[model samples]
Target: MSDRTFTLDDLRRILLESAGAEEGVDLYADISDTGFEELGYESLALLEAGGRIEREFGVSLDDVNLSDITTPRALVEAVNELLSVDTAAA
Candidate 1:
């Protein structure tokens, strides 16, 4: 398994950097269960954030179904799962 783990904080930062935090949206708060749409992030913003995550984490997200990952927690879990697979393959 990979030593690296994708946390909420990391996702928050990347989402902020990729598309910026929405006004009145407290990204610092516990948003793991919050949907991206509820957080004011559109599909484009999410795609951008996913791109950033892929590049930074050195993992391919093409196999994962983005439509199913509607929350920060889901995204983080997907990324970490991919990281674990990568480590196992290596």
Candidate 2:
């Protein structure tokens, strides 16, 4: 497992890098509860972001249903949970 704790900043960076933020979207704002669709991120974009997260963080997201993770906060929580599990295992 990676020694990195996934944060909102990390998610923002990955989302922007992977799929580019929407034109009018303020990714820096408090978007924890904002839905991805509201933020102009489609399912495809989120999939790409998930892939990037898996690669960058050395965690597997195979068990996570991206569709269920509608908000950035949920995604961050999920990734952190995986990271915590990895930490426990280590």
Candidate 3:
């Protein structure tokens, strides 16, 4: 696992790329207020994004409840919470 920390921009890029959005799509804009469904994303896209997040942040989110993560803020919060735990464990 890496020791790198992720920022909102990283998460946004990962998600947008995973979701197959066009280049330069800003997931952190007003779009963050919308759900994935509203953004035309499906479960598989989120799963891929989650995988990228794990690889990038060096944290496991396999046990996280994705159903509650409807927006970028929620995703960031979840990742931060997991990162805090990882930091504590280290």
Candidate 4:
């Protein structure tokens, strides 16, 4: 696993960059509470974001339901949980 530990800001930046770039949308604000669809993030955008996040964070989010991670905060929480599990395994 990666030794990197992500902060909320890091997660926010990653999500915004991934979704905005993938979806061609200007999600240039703090969207911690905003839903993905509301921010113009479709499945392709979200999946791309998830892939980037998984690769960057060194965690598998394959089992997580896409619908459950509608916002940046939710993604942060899920990533933290996965990181915690990795830590425990290590």
Best by lDDT: 2
lDDT of 4 by residue, 1-89 (tens): 54566666786576677754435555556667877777777888878878888888888988999777788778778888898889888
lDDT by residue (1-90, candidate 3, tens digit) is: 335556678877887678767455545577656777777667788889999988877888889988768877788878888887787778
* CA-only RMSD, every prediction: 1.3, 0.8, 2.8, 3.0
Q: Each candidate's TM vs. the true structure?
A: 0.94, 0.96, 0.80, 0.76
**Tens digits of per-residue lDDT for model 2 on 1-90?**
556799999999999999998998999999999999999999999999999999999999999999999999999999999999998888
Each prediction's Cα lDDT score? Answer: 0.91, 0.96, 0.76, 0.75
> Which pairs clash (backbone N, Cα, C closer than 3 Å) in model 2?
none
| Displacement of the residue 46 alpha carbon in candidate 3, Å | 0.2
Alpha-carbon deviation at 45 in model 4, angstroms: 0.4
**lDDT: the better of candidates 2 and 3:** 2
Q: How many clashes show up per model?
A: 0, 0, 0, 0
In angstroms, give how far residue 57 of model 1 lies from its true place. Answer: 0.4
Off by over 4 Å in 1: none
Which runs in model 2 stand beyond 4 Å of their true positions?
A: none
